[model samples]
Target: MHWQGCDVAFLTQHGKQHLVGPPIEAALGCRILHTEGYDTDKLGTFTHELARPGSQMDAAREKARIGMALTGSSIGIASEGSFGPDPVGGFVPWNTEVLLWIDQKQDLEITGWAHGHAQSLQKPIQSLQELELFALEAKFPEHRLTMRPSHEDHPAIIKGIHNVPSLMEAFERCRSQSNNGLVYVENDLRAFCNPTRQNIIRNAASDLIQKLQSLCPACDAPGFWVDRRIPGLRCRVCGRKTRLPISEVWHCQICKMQEERAIHTKALADPARCDHCNP
Candidate 1:
């Protein structure tokens, strides 16, 4: 077997293999082994009730590490996701998917990363009459909706309400118990429940596969990838220094060597972007 061809174990309980495994195998020319009955929720979950064990990066790394430890494979992979309003700046919802690739043989870790904006539904609804408006906006039945009382006094929160009958029951259930007599309805973004999220996961998997195919110029590591940014982009109009990334800092996880290359040519930001010039 090629050094990089060792099998990679994936730690997930949600059948993520349906979305994450095939492309990785094709790209890295390796096999994917899944850990059955592995409760990833112990590490963390989508619901805020169960706190994640660590930072997103840490959680992903540990998940991979545990898989490697259990399977006795030097290589392991895992994916983690964060969903909410845009992390940078936008009104739309965004999903950040992170894939961790770890090689214990070389003590190397590289991440395949992707982020995208998705049309997600999040609004409060008091009755079944209100769902019609949200259904149109969210494209209901295709994209599932979740529900919980607007004023949650107990742990029994309604989740994964897809159909109209189920949604009505959940809304009324919450309304009867809630002090506010309202329900918080939003999109159910679980990949299995939501098709839009599944597509994004597939896209992230493809990006990870591409990263595995890359080789570092410094040490020739198979998963050589970008780790940081070199900031200083010129604004397109004013030609002043703005805080945009000028280059991507690529590195070899095994060797710790670095390479910096500009993603584009502009060296400074336009005065329009500069606070001193614009403000």
Candidate 2:
């Protein structure tokens, strides 16, 4: 309580602290306080019930503020994640996990994120064989499943399908309840349920740790780091610019100071990536 940034209030309903807290605690040497009073689902839910407003970072900030207010801690932490199809061409889905840190006394807000392939699989099931296939691909048992009568807006829904027999029962019951004789089975995206997402959150926490380790040279405030990347890497062959970062702009978190540093003077953009050469 004496140190302004030593205690962090973590806001989570689905056990995110367990996944992300260890790395942060190790990196910052701070006590992690999990807030139990806040309704995290009220902000938004994976089931699509309460539509989340604002950008992911905005939601994360709100969550952190709520936790700090409830716990009377100057430091607050929260995470927001989104799952969907891979931006690059791929059959499997992807997850973007973002971890946010807010230090009120230091006036610092830092975000770290990890994005890549995700194991969040979901599909409409009609047959036992199909269900088994889906489960196999989704890493069943390791990753829990959820069932609903339909994709959305169905009263009869079975959640937290962990075991084989329970999954079997839920599939049959939900399929029968569906108007189309089909059940929507999705990988439980909750942090407690999905190990893949848990790992992603851990990665994001590591990113935050790296960013927080840096202090502003001018003001000595934490979270002083790269603010922007300048892209104008010139091709070696024709000397035309390509959309690759040539310099990084560093800024102070507390003091209004900025410095731009050029990267790797010896390196040049390959002709393959140059728009004029490739196009």
Candidate 3:
């Protein structure tokens, strides 16, 4: 059951197919079959208690295998998201999106990356008077809220509210349950709950299209993309080796062919990037 030309399986508990499925279909002539009731949560979950089983690549490939097993489809797709401190700077929040494409027929796999600042879509209100301002900021009812006691006496004292009356009720209820009598309200980050995250998904879908379209020079396999870089570029000023990429290593999954190509850029690394010079 191919849509454009290729048959692929889409494994998701969330309705992510609405965002990621189309790009593969359009770019690579693929059809996507949804794998329902596949307990991807068993592999890992967002909650702190359920630690993810492996590195990003391993998890993604496992998800693809699960999809393929469910539908007996040769091609599969999956997406993963990790939200935490910025890799570049530890302070700011960073939301990283990863998309994985697998072609069992060709034994090829490709991944796409996207991330940016998340607006959070949340703000707190301590008083009834602040409701107007909070509503204006959050666009309440359109974007719902989760309210809980700032300090919990009972772990079950949490509420998800949409309407103004319910919001006020939940806030007061949570405050009453807290020893400090304060409530914290924030946006729910579930895909359906957060529009910002959905936008990131769309952007990652686009990136996947580009990755699937790319072909390996050696094996002519789809998803031939850069895996990593060989560092030790020379400093422009000192001629000393610096910590910058000198060549890019591209690989083909099906043929296990790897090629290292010199970087196109001629600009040498600055002294600041040199460990000996800078340190």
Candidate 4:
């Protein structure tokens, strides 16, 4: 209970405090000082208006830093989310959420991550009927949408279309303004707009809570979790090593302590995963 009754700053404009704040407060007995003093959209936006400058981790760190500065708190937390194709299948849409916790008092930084299927969709529509179909597939109303004239990058964009009437209005307006009679529609990725992404953010918060609770055996500092996986699992058939991890390396950031623990799921990797045998 290192963080019991501690105050931490959290900066977000998309209502992420509701999704990320409670669990940490409940678990660590910390107070979440939510603030929207700065427009986080300036860092990056899902509508492509402003491109995120750095890597996902960098963005989250910057956000936490800003929150700490704004609230003048020693500790801060923030969450960032990205959407793309799933890594394994490369076909289904995927969402990855990262939650960063920075403790200036202890000079410790910990991150939590979660990834899963995302209800994200985009398409060009020429008529209201097509817009309806796309909305259905995009999980409209439940998950809000953004519309732009002609293409996704168009500057004339309408966002937060929650209901059918607003959706129709945005479609017609964009369609009329489009040079090619097409309106680009996509699921609004803001945490408040998209419930699917919100759920992923919640999971990321849960991960952060777990990491925060795992105290280091050496220094009694939090966030003593697996840092990396060692890959050298032997192939079951050929006895050759594969890319699969044979053990995990747990490290404590505060004390710089390390421990290697063997994975016991399977003694040998599958033959199909062996590079030499498969190739």
Best by lDDT: 4
**Regions of candidate 4 where Cα sits further than 4 Å from its true position:** none
RMSD (CA, Å), candidate 3 to true, equals: 3.7
> Residue 171 CA error for candidate 2 (Å)?
1.0
Reference-based lDDT, each prediction = 0.75, 0.85, 0.72, 0.93
Give the range of the ten consecutive residues with the poorest summed lDDT in model 4.
Answer: 124-133
Model 2, span 65-167: residue lDDT tens: 9999999998899999998888878666889999999988877888888997887877987889999999999899999988888665565667779999999
The Cα error of candidate 4 at residue 196, in Å, is: 0.8
Candidate with the greatest TM-score versus the true structure:
4
Q: Write the per-residue lDDT of candidate 3 for residues 1-279, one digit (tens) a residue.
A: 222576688888767888877766777677788887588778775433257879767787888888989898888888887777777877766678888887766656677888976535444446766766766666566666666665422354343466878877887787677666456666555555557778898888888877777777776767777889999799877888876999999877777788888997867887888887787
Tell me the tens digit of each residue's lDDT in model 1 across 1-279. Answer: 233466888887766787888777665678888985467778865645577867889999888988888787888888888887887676778888888888777776767777787646777777667867887788787887777776433456777777889877877787777667677777776666777777777887887777777788877777777889876776666665567788898877667788887786555576766765678
Assess every candidate by TM-score: 0.84, 0.94, 0.80, 0.98
lDDT of 2: 0.85
Q: Rank order by TM-score, top first?
A: 4, 2, 1, 3
* Global local distance difference test of model 3: 0.72
